[model samples]
Every structure is written in structure tokens, then in C-alpha cells.
Target chain A: MPLEDQLLVERSKKGDREAFEHLVQLYEQKVYTIAYRLMGNHADAADLAQDAFIKIYQALPNFRGDSSFSTWIYHITVNVCRDELRKRQRRPTVSLDDNNSDGNNYTYEIRSTAPGPEEMLDRSETQVMIQQCLDSLNDDYRTILIMREIQELAYEEIAEILGCSLGTVKSRLSRARQALKEKISKQMEPLSPCKRLAK
Target chain B: MRCQDVMELLSPYLDGALATEEREAVRLHVARCPKCSAELEELRACIGMLKELPLIAPPTGFRVGLMEKIDQLPSQQGSSKDKNIFDRVTGIARSSWYRVVAVAAVMAMAVGITSLWEKEGVQFLPLEQKPKGVVAVHEPQKASKEPPVVKEQQPSQVGQSSEPGASGSKSAVNSKGSGVKQPDPQQGNATVPVITEAVKKQVEGYVPKPSTGMAVVSASLRLDVVDIEAALKSVGSIALDNGGTYLGSQDSGSIGIKVPRQSFERVIGALQKLGGVLSYLPTEKDVSVQHQTAKAELERLKAEQGELQTKLTSEPSQELERQLADLNQALLKQIDTMKQLEDRTNHCLINITLQ
Candidate 1:
């Protein structure tokens, strides 16, 4: 934590509304970005980000600074989005006690916009195509890819956040990367330099 | 190692997480393999695109909305410092969902039986209703050590509410020192001065000095009024009376007004008189630094534009045309900055939120 953030955290913990707003302004951009990436839309992203901050405010008293404030807040953000995704999926909450082999069996039923590679001729902007591909992926793969590639969180940190083992994190990241590659190639074939180079 | 094995290890290899022997094995296989190498590059490019996604800014008034939400919450000085609220809720739900449902079902059955027993004709239980009477008279203790719990559930309305611990004085704000939270807004009349002690302190601490120079000043006032539309119209008329223009509303339940610097104090006073204030924030920025910088940059850009115009007129060339375009871009940007500063210095903006 920076000296300024430490002081602000101290003030916010004491119920200083001004200090708390200052903290919000400091991290709102990154939090909003994470929410936008995970939620894939503006309205839900705004709501999720606000909800994440509200939870953070409610939970600040207990925040003993075990991790850096950013990590804790990002973890909260991820959890909030995960809960929302689960709710939308209407799946039973997976029990942590269950001896699930790799936490990989729980795949969300995404309405795949995944067209075949041959049909991927109408090219969009690279950024737009990439986001579309991300939106088409299963929730588990999308979440893991966002955590690893966008947030750049460490493997150990990712494991701790997902409550999974390190091996699980590594395996999931690999599968997510492969999934994203397939999605992108399905949506953006000619635009993919590697595909053209390989041909 | 076969190509299949190399392909599986490609992701971890990109992250440099593979051990020495395994990394060497994958590396030697990819050295002769084009397909496996292309797969690695493709994944790398995909990750790069994901990383390159631009972060979007939240809509305006996000901070304001969030702060208002926090204000309505129960006292912030909480005791549970070990785990977060989400974790606690999720833990219970995951571990004890069945137990919780069983308890709820049992309670429902008990309620049904009790209602049956209470019926005169349909007596579910046979005996001792009239045999023995144990009347326990409970006294309402006003001086109990525990304070009353105020559930601020609904939208908190402003103005003349019979709020808890409030003197109900019509002077608007609770000028006295009290830390009482507003009673449930779903119920009637939280009609006291609910301007919190912290808010009052902050408002008093910000004493704006008289400014002869151009300065941009603004204030944020939040009131939980019963009628948002009426309050907004009332505030607009008040601003107009003080020679201010209504900037209209950017969002629901909020209005923005711009008043001349001279009547800024009068406008603030009149607006405070409109309803009960939930929170107050006053801010002033001496834009001398900005004004001075903008003015100097504006002058410099104009002079450069003049020079470019002269060059373009004398020499008809593509180079001169390109220079002219570049100068226009810079000149337009400089003017935009200066114009923003001038707009800021013109008047004071009062952001009134009627919730």
C-alpha cells in the first residue's frame, strides 16, 4: 500500500465518508474495467462495480490488510461477478468439499455465436472481434482468461481467489487460452496473422 | 516428445512455468515443428488482444449515487472484522442450506398449529387455556442502555420529518449535535434536521473567502424530499430568482443550477431553506493557475497560427497545407481548454439531489 492509500484506508476505516470517496475515485476505473470485461455490457457492469464497492465498504471494517487493498478489492469484484453468472446460469452452487477432480466439469451453457472458420469472412475491428469472441466463451473460461490475461494476476493469487489448487489454475489457464484461440479464429480468420502465416 | 505433448505444454511454456527438463523437451519438439509453433503464436496473439482491451469510464454521477447509498446504510462502525459479508452469507448457504430449510418448515408447521389452537370452535389442543392465567406485564423502558434501531429501508424523504432524537425544529438542519440515523423512510415523517454532525462539521470548516479574481466554485446538496419533481421545480425558480440559470437535470432526482458569483451565497441559503439537507459539500478552486496557463497558451497558439497562415498564403505547397492542418488542430485544442476555463469561472454550480 502507498503511504497515501494507507492514510486514506485508516480514515475510511474510521467511517470518514470523504476518505472513502477518495478511495473509490482511486480504484473506480480499474474496478469498472474488470466489471465491464466480466459482465460484457454497460448496465450490468455499472451495477456490478457499484455493488462491489458497496460490499467493500460494508466489509472494510474487517479488512485487516492481509493482502494489498487492490488484491482484496479485485477479489471481491471477481466474486460478485461470479455470483451473478451463477445466478444467471441457475446452476446449483458447487460444494468445495466435493472431491471434484479439477473444478472443470462446471461449464456454463453459453449460446455459442461460434461460426465455423470458413464463414468468418466479414471482418470487424480486431478489438471488437476479440471482445465478441470473449463473450461467446463459457463463463469459466472467460473468467479465467480475464483474470490471467487482463488482470495479470499471479497463478498462486488466482488459485487463492478461486479456492482451487495451483495445478488447477495452470490447467484452466491453458484450456481457457486454447478456447479463446478457437473463438477468435472462428470469428476473425483472415485478420489472424498467425493463421495467414501458417497457411 | 511427440507433437501432441508439445501442444499441451505450449500454454505453460508461454508463461515460463514449466520446469527445466519439461521446458527443454517442449522446446526441442517445437524446434522442428511448424504447426505446434503456430499454435503457440496464435494463443500468444489472442492473449495480447485481451490485454489490449481499453478500460471504460463509469457513467457520470456514479460516485454521487454510491455515496448516497452508503449514507442510508446502518452505522458504518461495524464489529465483524474477520470475514466479509459475502463470504459469511455464502458459507452459511453452502454448508447449511438443508438445515435452514428444515428449520423453516418446522416453524411453518408450528405457526399453522398455533393458529388452529387460537380458533374458538376448532380447538386443536384440548385443555388448559382457561385453567391457569400467567399475565406477564411488560413495561416499556425509555431509558434503556441500547439505542433504538432505525431501518432506513425506503427512499428517505426530506423536509419536516419527525426523525428520531430530532427536536423537530423548522429551522431545517439539526444545528444541534446528534448522531441519530434517520428512521425508516417507508414510515412517515423523519421530519427533523437530519444534516449529520460530520456533514455539518465539514460544511462549517469550508468557509469560502471573498474572491475578486475568477474562480470556479460549486456545492453539492442532498435532500431526501417527498416529491422529487416538485423540489426540482422549486429549486429552479429559486436559482432564477437569484439571477441563475437552471442547467436542468443530468439524471433523475437531481438538478443543476448555475448562479452568478455574487449571488452564490444567497442561492445556497435559499436552497437550504427548501428542504431538509441530507449532506452538504462545498468546493472552490482558484483557477488562477489554469486561467493564466490557458490565456498564455491561447496567445501562443494564435501567434503560431498567424505565422502558418502567412506561410501558406506565400507558398502554395502540400507541405504548407499539412502544416496548416496541424496548426489548426493545435489551435482548436488550445481554445477548447481556454473556453472550459472561462466557463468554469463564469458562475457557481449547485448540484442539488432531491431523493
Candidate 2:
């Protein structure tokens, strides 16, 4: 833990609301992003992120610094998302329509050197397609994929968060990537034969 | 490497998670094999697309909204230490042993106190000790055989006091002594002392000694407010300003407030100013006896716990250690009850209903 975060956790454990708010500000975006990718919607993601922070605040006192603060937070976020997904499964409410009509407005801004307009448009469409495919996977596979590929967490960290062994993490990540690849490939099958063959 | 082995290692190869030897094997095989190369390239593109997915910025004012929700959480749940205490206290209070013991003890105490007051002809005074105007309603037909003690106390005109207007003092005494049956000590000389001693022992066994006098002040107020939510917020603020807490609100537009005992009246007054007072009922319950009883029990249990601790240190027996553990648990429960009672007495509860 960074000295600043360690101090904040200690103060938060002591019931300092300000300290907790500071901690929330520090990690809210990261936590929200992970939740968004896992949940695939802004509303559920935001709600889950807030819920996770509240849970993290409640569970902070039992935090013994066995893992980094970020790892602990990621663990809590994953659990919150999993629980919400479980609840949705049981209740089976009619989810809102995909509402991807505005998909064109969302462009993937890659960190590499800026691409041309045509390249950017293709990348944006590919990003949205990948997200849709990712959302279609089972909770276990999607969660592992997001934690590894998007959050960029280490295998050890993922294992700790998932409460599995390092070997399990490796196997799960491999399976998750394979599952995602199969989904994307199945979606691309309907496209032109030339595009498919080029790959 | 064969196609199957190459395919199995491709995912890890893309992640750079494979061992160096495995990575080399997959690399060399994919370089020469078009089929395996296509598979690896496809997996790489999928992962790259995932990694390049746009980061969604949280809704605006998320931090503020989260902080507000955190503030709304019960104070006890915000800290693990407080949550532990709350959980343990609720657990003990809900446990069968505690429930049975507490109910039995309270019943026994009530019975003992009633019997004591009857036998000793003790007048139980209200906690406030205020004297009210007496109303005498005559019902001569209901009078039983008057005890000799009563007659002896007013011997001047025993028969002459039969007149309704003249018998005020006698009637008052009769009314006060209505429920008690005075056993004739002379009729059973040998049984009297034994019965009295048995009753005394039973009463003493159940009721712990009372300690300091502490009063719990509670008030209920109904207000006709133009704005219910604003009135509720004002009531909450009043409690906070008076070094207290806004416990919660019910669906019936009633809010529960807790303020320091010393500021109970002040909080009530402030609440009254919030809107037109429709109804206000303020009461004081002297829980001194109950508080003291729990405290005494806690002390006794703690003393026993200390002795058990000493015994364990000297002569370690599994049976003794088990007994010690049970005693310690009981001690913690008693202490929790004492603390709860003390808190209740120190802070007053005010239920405010907004119309």
C-alpha cells in the first residue's frame, strides 16, 4: 500500500468519513471501469461500484494488509458484480433493450499513435462488437477476462481475488480468452468470405 | 510441437504467461504452420480488441453520491468494532438462554416486589414523588373484615366512624389496604416465621440489589407541519445539535430521535417549534433498578470469571477451562446488557409524528 492509501485505510477503519471519501475518490474510476466491463451497462456498473465502495468501507477494518489495497478493492468489486449477476439470474427481470443504436458515438481511443479517420471508425466498431461478445460469456469467463485483459491484474492477484490457485488462474484465463475468441469468430462468420479469409 | 499442443499454448503465448521453453515451442510451430498461425493471430486480435475497449467514465457526481450513501449507512455498521459489539449484543439478546433468563428474572422480580409491598404494607411511590389530590369513592359493601392493626390505629370512635362522611380516614386506609390479606400471626405461630423467611429468601434470590437512581426520559410528539420532510429534517437536526442521533423514521411519518437525557426537554421544545403541536406525551421511566440489576449481575459474573481465570492458571483442567469459557461468555453478555441499559437511560427517545 502507498503511504497515502495506508493512512486513508487506517483512518477509514477508525470511522473517518473524510478518509473513506478520499479512498473512494482515489479508486472510483478504476473500480467503476471494471464494474462497467463486467456488467455491460452504465447504470448497473455505477450502482455496483457504489455498492462495492460501501462494502469495502464496511470490510476495511478486517483488512490485514495481506494484499495490496488495490487488490483488496478489486476483490470486493468482483464479488459485488458476481452477487448482482447472481441476483439477476434468480429474479430474471426484463432487462432494458441493448440500446446500441448510439454505438457509433462510442469510439475506442487506443493509446497508440492516433490513427486515421477510417482506422478509428473500424476500431470503434470492433470494440463495440468485442464488448457485445464479452457480455455474452458466462459470468466466470467474462469476469476473468476483464480482470486479466482490461484491468491488467497479475495472475497472483486474480487468484487471490478469485480464491483459486495460480494454476487455476492460468487455465481459467486461457479458457476465457478462447471463449471470447470463439464468440467473435462466430459473429464474423456472417461477414464477407474475403474478410474472413484475410484473417 | 503438434497442432494440439500449439493451440493449447497459444492463449498463454499471447499473454506472455507461458514458460520460455513453451513460448519458444509455440512460436517456432506457429511460424512454420499456417493453420496454427491463423489461430494465434485471431486470439491476439480478440484480446487486443478487449484491451482497447474504451474506459467508461462513471456518472457525474459519483463520488458525492457515494459519500451521501455512506453517510446514510447506520453509524454502527460503518466501523467493524461497533458492528461487532452490535452483533454480539443482538446475538445474546436473541439467544434462548438470555431470553429465558431475562424473562424469568423479570417475572420473579415483579412477583417478589409485589409480595414484599403487600406483606410489609409498603407504599410504592412514583418516581417523581409528586402528591396528587385524593378522590374518595365509597363502596361499603365491598369492604372485608378490617384488620386489627387498622382498627387499632384509629380506636377513638370505631363504631361511630361507620357514617360515610365521617369515615374518610378509615376509608382511605381501607382503600390503600384493599388488596393485602393480613395473615393472623397468632393463628399459626410455628408456620408464620417459616413462611416469612421462605418468601424473603425467594425474593432475595431473584432481585439483585438496586444502585443509583437514573431516569429515562422519552417523549412522543405529533406535529401538523406544512412540509413533512422539512419538519423531519429539523427534528433530526435538533437531535444532532443536542448531542444525540436521529435513530430512524417509520412509514407512518414518525421519526425516532435520541437526545441526551439532560437535553431531552430542550429537544422536545425545539421539536414543538417546528410545527403546530397536535399531541405531545413526555414520560420518564426510572430504569435505575433494572440498570443496577444488570450491572450487579455483570460485576458478580466478572468476579467469578476472574476467579476462574486464576484457577485455570494454577490447575489446568479441561472441565475447568470449559466452565471458564462459558462464564466469560455469560459475563460478556451481561456487560453488553448493562451497557445497553446505561445507554438507554443516558439518552432519551423522542418519537415525532408529522401530520
Candidate 3:
């Protein structure tokens, strides 16, 4: 945990509102991205992340210094996102937009001409589809991929976050890498480089 | 350089998570084998692409919004240290400082109130003059420690109201409970109405008709269907066809629905369309007896509140004023719970599971 987070945690234990708020500020993006990877869309991810934060806040007073705050927060977020995924599985699949086959259509593009934001909505949307492809993966595969690639957590740290043996973490990551490779390869076939290379 | 050996090293090499010795071994092996090199490159690209997966930055002010929400939560000071109410009370019991402060506060209030009363020549308040109504119907229900459990069950029961006028205090949530569980509208569609009507008929003769222009109904059912989705659509169409809508649903595949009391049979006929019926859960939950008791208690509280308020104005002692404030708070909490229960019971919550 960062010094700021440690400071916030101490203050929060003493019931300081500002300190808790600062903690939420520091972690919202990281938590949100974890939820986004698992749930696959902006709306569901946002909802899951918010719920996890609420649980984290509620559970803050119970902090026992057993784990780093980041690890604890990650555990809470993954658990929350998992619960959300289960709930979603039970319900009928309803997309907010039906014209697009992919649920990743919910991703908005900032459409700019230069590197600063010039990408077309199509490019942004394709990026969203790639994310959706990532989301369609199984829980074990998705979490390993996200932790290894996006969050860049080491194998040992991931094991701690997931509460699994390091061997299991490594095995899951190997499988996740293979699965993602196959998916991206398949998805990239339509693009120019991949198509030309294939030919 | 067998496939198995290459495979063993692939994960770490692909991740750049390998040690120097392992990295050198894999590098030499891949360099010597075209297939292994191609595989490594592909793995690297795949991992790189996954890393590049467009991270949707959460909406700006996410932290601000989250912090605002955190600030809004009632401080968890009481529950954090103590697991439950018993633990909390025990902690208070064990604390000498808490005991001393509590006793001192009570003594100070008593002396201050007495001196003020003596100075003003105030008379004692008589309880008989308090007005009795729904406000009075609220306390025993509130004090029963029943609200949280009832609130928890409300989502499960909201589809079929077993108790008529049982107000479901669950606000209209787009998702299910306060947990991360999204409110499954599809589940609500399938089970809400069949259970609602069953509860209505159950309460028809057993419960007293509310004198306050309200009705109570209760029913129990076991809906056996092969597919939960098809059942929900069929039941939803039934409610829609009969001019009703779904209220809620349970994980067991039971649904709660609300239809006009007059079209009860139509809703029942619609539910029967939901495929083969197994044994329906019995809605013998007779709130009538409990309802009467709660109504009486609520009336009594209202009367008490009125008496306290009147005494506060007339006698104006600090103790009386504090007591009046306490009574009002209790009364409000009770009313809120009753109103919630009333909403839930108004609709029938049907519990069902498909084999």
C-alpha cells in the first residue's frame, strides 16, 4: 500500500470521512478496470465496481492488517465481480443495443484526428470488441490474463490476491495466454496485416 | 527441446516472468526451432494485445462520486469492532467509561428536568389523551427486529404477496437486492403474479379487512417447469394480458405479481399456463392475527407520541422533551417498516423451482 493509502486507512479506522473519500479516489480506476474486464461492459462494470467499493468501505473498519490494503481491495473487487457474473448468468441476456452483435458496443469513442483522440468510433468500437472477447473468457482465464497483462501483478502477488497456490496461478496464466492468443488470432484475421500474412 | 519441455517454459517466457537461466534456455531452444520461435512470437503478441485491450477509463469524477457515497454511509463505527448487536451491547456492558458516562448523562438530565419542572410548576402528563392510528400500528412491528429479515425476504416475496396490504418497503430497484446481484427482471416476470394471487386468496377469509381502505391477500405455490425463462415469459404475458405487472421473483423460480383483486382468476389461469404444477408451497403465513396485534401496537404508539408531544408543550421539561423526541423517532421507524410490509403483501410473492 502507498503511504497515502496507509494514512487514509488509519484515519478511516478512526472514522475520518475525508480519509475514506481519499481512499476511494485512489482506487476507483483500478477497481473499475478489474470489474470491466470481468463483466465486459461499461454499465455492468461500473455497477459492480461501485458495489465492491461500497462493500470495501463497509468492511474497512474490520481491517486487521493481515494483508496489504491493495490485495484486500482486489479480493473484494474480484469477489463482487464474480457475484455479478453469476447473477448475470441466471438472467436472460438483454443488450441495450441490439443492432450490434457484440455487447462491447457500449464503449464510447472520443473520435479525434491525431493520437490525442483522432481514432474513429469504429476503431474504438473494435477495441471494445477485443475487450468483449476478453470478457467472454472463463473466470480463471480472464482474471489471470487481466492480472498478468493489465494490472501487471507478479505470479506470487496474483496468487496472494486470488488466494491460490502459485502453481495454480501459473497454470491458469499459461492456459489464459493460450486462449487469448487463439481468440485474438481469430479476431485479427480480418485486419490487413493478419490477412496479408495468412495469404 | 521436446514440445513438453517447451510447453513447460512457455508461460514464464511468454509473460517475461521467467528467471535468467530459464529465459536463456527457452531463448536458445526457440532460436534453434522455427516452430517454437513462431509459437513464442505468437504468444508474445497475444499477451501484448491483451495488455493493450482498451481500458475504459471510468467516468471522470468516479472517485469523487464514490467518496461522496462513502461519506453518505452511516459511520460503521458500531458494527466494525463488534460483529453484531449482542457483541455491541456486550462491549458497552464491559466498558466502565461507557457505564459512567451513561449514568452521568441520565443523572444530569433528571436533575435539570426536575429543577425546570419545579420552577414552572408543571403537572405530570396523562397518557389517555394520545390519539391512536397507523402511527400506533407501527411499533411492535418495528421493535420485533423483523425489519431486516423482512427486508431481506422482500425481494424473494415481492412477486407474490402472501399478506394483503403487506407493503413491500423495498424501493423500486432496477436490480435485485442491495448486494451486487442485479434485479433479474426476467425472473420477476415469470413468478410474481401467480404467487401474488395465491396469497390474496389465502388471506381472503383469515385476515381482517383493513379499516383503512386496504386489502390483504396470501397464497403458496410450487410451479414445476423445465425451463425458467419460458415460464417467466408465459407468466409475464399472462399478467400483461390480464392487465397486471410483475413485482419480484425468487432464486427458486417463484414469482410475485400484482393484479387487480377483481381479475384474480384470470391471473391464476395465466399462472396455470406456466406448465405442470408441482406441490404449491402453502401460504399459511397468517398475518391477520399478527396484523391485528401490530395495528393495536401502532395505535398505542401514536397515542403515546401525542401524549408526549402535548406534555412537552404543556410541562416543557427537558426530560419530557427528550422522551417526546425519542417516541417520535420510534414511531417513524415503525411506520416506515409497516408501509414497506404493506407494499409487499399488496402484491403476491410466489416461490417456485423448476426440476
Candidate 4:
């Protein structure tokens, strides 16, 4: 934990609201990104991130120092996402209808994007295509990829946050990349038959 | 490296987590393996694209907004030092009720003392079987039959009395008399005494001494209920559920009952559901602190009594010996009262006054 975060946590537990504001300002963006990438929506991600902060406030006093504050917050964020996932599973919905659907709904794609960022210009169709490719991934695959790649969490940290073993984190990251690669390749086949044939 | 193995390390490599050795192994293998190399190239492009993905900062004025929200939050009621002082003062205030109860008790006790003091002291004939000192005097209603000793005693003689109320004087005498008589059972084991005897013994200080151990716990709850029976049933059920027997109850107004401490909350919740709870007060009474002090005192008394018994056997001075016996008797009396108080507190008294 940062010295400031540790100090803030101490002060917050003593009911110092100012110290806690410093904490919220520091991590809200990172926390928001994790929620956004996992859920693949602006509003839901924003809501989940806000909810995670509220939980952090409630659970701060009971934090026993077993893990780093980042890791603990990461775990909480992931838990909130998983709960959102399970809720969606319980009551499936058409993904495009409502962006702010009650957490019990999500969308899935048949194929995932290929591995790597094939240099797309900023704000170009390709960039949009790449994001769509990411959206095509299954919840599990997208989550592992986002945590490991975008968030740059270590296998152990990812494992702790997701409540899985290091081996599971490794395997999921592997399959997620493979799935994305296959999806991207399949999407590109019609655009260039020669490229497909050459491969 | 196999496709699966290469794929696992690919995410870590993209994240820059791969150790030098593993990075070398993957780099060396992928260079010759066209398919794996292509996959690695694509993975690299994905990382590049992720890097360029627009950074979405929290909404405008994120920190300012957050700080404003946090500032609006409730602050700590007091600092540690203040809480410490509050706790100490509150503790004293909480237990001060005992002093109030004690004063009332002292006044009630005054009447009994005059009768015990006025009667001729009961002297037992030495038992043939027991030692000469082992005398048992049968004085059934001994204090009760002695008609109002308060009426006959000279006002001036009672605590250097200045007031005309000698009947009330008996109250003061009984209070002192009760205080002193409270330690006799430690003298010897005869027969365990009963009700009036127990009261006299307590007034005189015999067995099952007065307890300072009684714990008073209070709890209240609010619930929506249709009628009084439902509330009564709920309270009864709570007590029954928690292995507590309901002692007493009131219904037309709010209900009140004493329960074991362990049953405190369960009973309170049940009663709360009896009506739409307008207000609630819940508290725990812990006699542990008082019990601990009383036990230490009892232990000291027992040790002193043992020392005096030894002195009574071996010493020769008459005045010294009588003084020792009196000390031994006082300690014994106190020890008994202390034990009774312990029993009372250990019972975990939960008093529920519900609306």
C-alpha cells in the first residue's frame, strides 16, 4: 500500500472522512476501468465501480491486513462483477435492448478477437472493430484478458482477486487469447481471401 | 513451446511479467515456428491497441466531487481521549444506580436491626456431640417476636440520635445490624439455614450472602403487530426460544420482562414485532467487573478467617482472642454476602421494557 493510502485507511477507520476522500480520488479511475472492461458498458461499469467504493467504505474497518489494499479492492471489484454476472445468468436478456439493464443480463459473441493490436488508427473503424471483437469474448475469457493484459495484474494477484488458483488464471488467459485470435482471423477471412489462403 | 503453453506466457509477456529465461525460451521457439510467431505478432498488436484505448478519467471534477461527498459524511463523534473519558464517566454514572438501589435498601433494612439488637442475645448450650464451642441456639422468629424494639430504645442511645423518630431509628439500627450479621456461616458448618432464618442470617449475615453480581440488561424493539396477544406470544416465544423463562409481563401499556442475558436480543426482537416500534432502548448489564472485585474480597476474607482460627487455637491472651474472633466473624459474614451477589449477577438478568 502507498504510505498515503495506509495513512488514509487509518484515518478513515477512525471516521476521518477527508482522508478517505483522498483514497477515492486516487483509485476511482482504475477501479472504474476494471468494472467497465469486465462488464463492457459505460453505465453499468460506472455503477459497479461506484458500488465497489461504497463497499470499500463499509469494509475498511474489518480489513485485517492480510493482503495489499489494491489487491483487496481488486478482489471486491471482481466479486461485485461476478455477482452481476450471476444475476444476469439468472435472468437472461437481449443485450442491445437496454444498456442499463438490471444486472441480470449480458451479451455473448460466437467468436473472439485474435491476439495483438493490429495497429488501427485512433477513432478509426478498425479501432471500433477491435473493441467489438473484445466484446465478442465470453465473460470468463474477457475478464481474464482484461485483468492480465489491460489491468496488468500478475497471475497470483488475478488469482486472488478472482478467487481461483494461479494455474486457473494462467489457463484462462491462454484460452482467452487463443479464442480472440481465432475470432479475429475468421472475421478477416472474407476481407482478404488471399491472406486467408496464404495462412 | 506448444500452442497452449505459448498462449499462457503470451498474456504475461504482453503485460511484461515474463522472466528473462521464459521470455528467451518463447522468443527462441516462436522465431522458427511460423504459426506461433504469427500468433505472437497478433498478441503484440492487441497490447499496442489496448495501450491506445482512450483513457476514460472519472467524470469531471472527480476528486472535487468525491471530496465533497466525503466531507458530507458523518464524522467521528469523539476522539480517542474524549471517548476514554466519556466511557469512564458513563461507567460511573451507570453503576451509580446501584448506589441509589443501595440507599433504598439501607432504609428498608433499618427496621430489622432494632429488633435484633434489643432482644437478649441467643446463647446455645454446648452440644454433647460437638465441641464445647460448637453451640446451636434455636431462636425461631427470634427477631420477629421481639415487639418493635424501635419503640422502647432511648432515642439518644441510637446512633447519638437527635431526632424523635425511634421507629425510624430501628431502620438505621437494622441497617448496621444487617451489615454486621452478614458473615457467620464461615464460623462452622451446622445445618444449612432456610427462608426466615436465611433472611435473619442475611440480616445477621449468614449464608447465600447479598450479591453485587446481578446484571441488568435492557432491550427494545419495534414491529408491526395487530394485537397484544401477538406481542405477548412473540415475547414469550423469544424467551422460550433462548432458554429463558419469562418472569413477569405487562400488556395494556408496553410489556416488560426479565430474561437471561443470552436471550436478550431474541426476546427484544420478538417483542418489538408486537407493535409498530415508535422507539427502542437496548442495553447490556455486565456484573463481571463487580463480581471480580467481590470474589477477590471473599478470598481475602477466607484467608484472614483461616489465620484467626489458627490464632484462636494457639493464642493465650483473652482480650486479643476475643478481638480475633470478632474479626473472623466479620470476614465470614462478608464472604457469604459476596457469594450471593455473585449468584445474582451470574444469572444474566435481561430486562425488556418494550413498546
The CAPRI quality class of candidate 3 comes to incorrect
Q: Candidate 2: where is the Cα deviation over 4 Å?
A: A90-120, A189-199, B76-355
For candidate 4, the TM-score of chain A alone versus the native chain A is: 0.74
lDDT of 3 by residue, B269-348 (tens): 56766777776543424455555666676678768865665554444443663465455445544554566556545655
TM-score of each: 0.50, 0.47, 0.46, 0.41
Candidate with the larger DockQ of 2 and 4 = 2
Return whichever of 1 and 4 wins on lDDT: 1
DockQ of predicted model 2: 0.22
Instruction: Please give, for residues B116-157, the per-residue lDDT of candidate 1 as tens digits.
Output: 676757765444442111100011232132221111111132
Which should have the higher DockQ, number 1 or number 4? 1
- For A13-113, candidate 4 gives per-residue lDDT tens digits of 75555577778877886777677666766556656777787778767878877888887887788778768976886322223224443343323212123
Ten-residue stretch with the least lDDT total in model 3 chain B: B130-139
For residues A94-199, write the lDDT of model 1, one tens digit per residue.
2212322323222111122455655333322455567767777788888888898878899899999999998999898998888888887776566555544122
Q: What's every prediction's RMSD, in angstroms?
A: 24.7, 27.1, 24.6, 29.9
Error of 1 at B262 (Å): 9.4
| iRMSD of all candidate structures | 8.7, 9.4, 8.9, 12.5
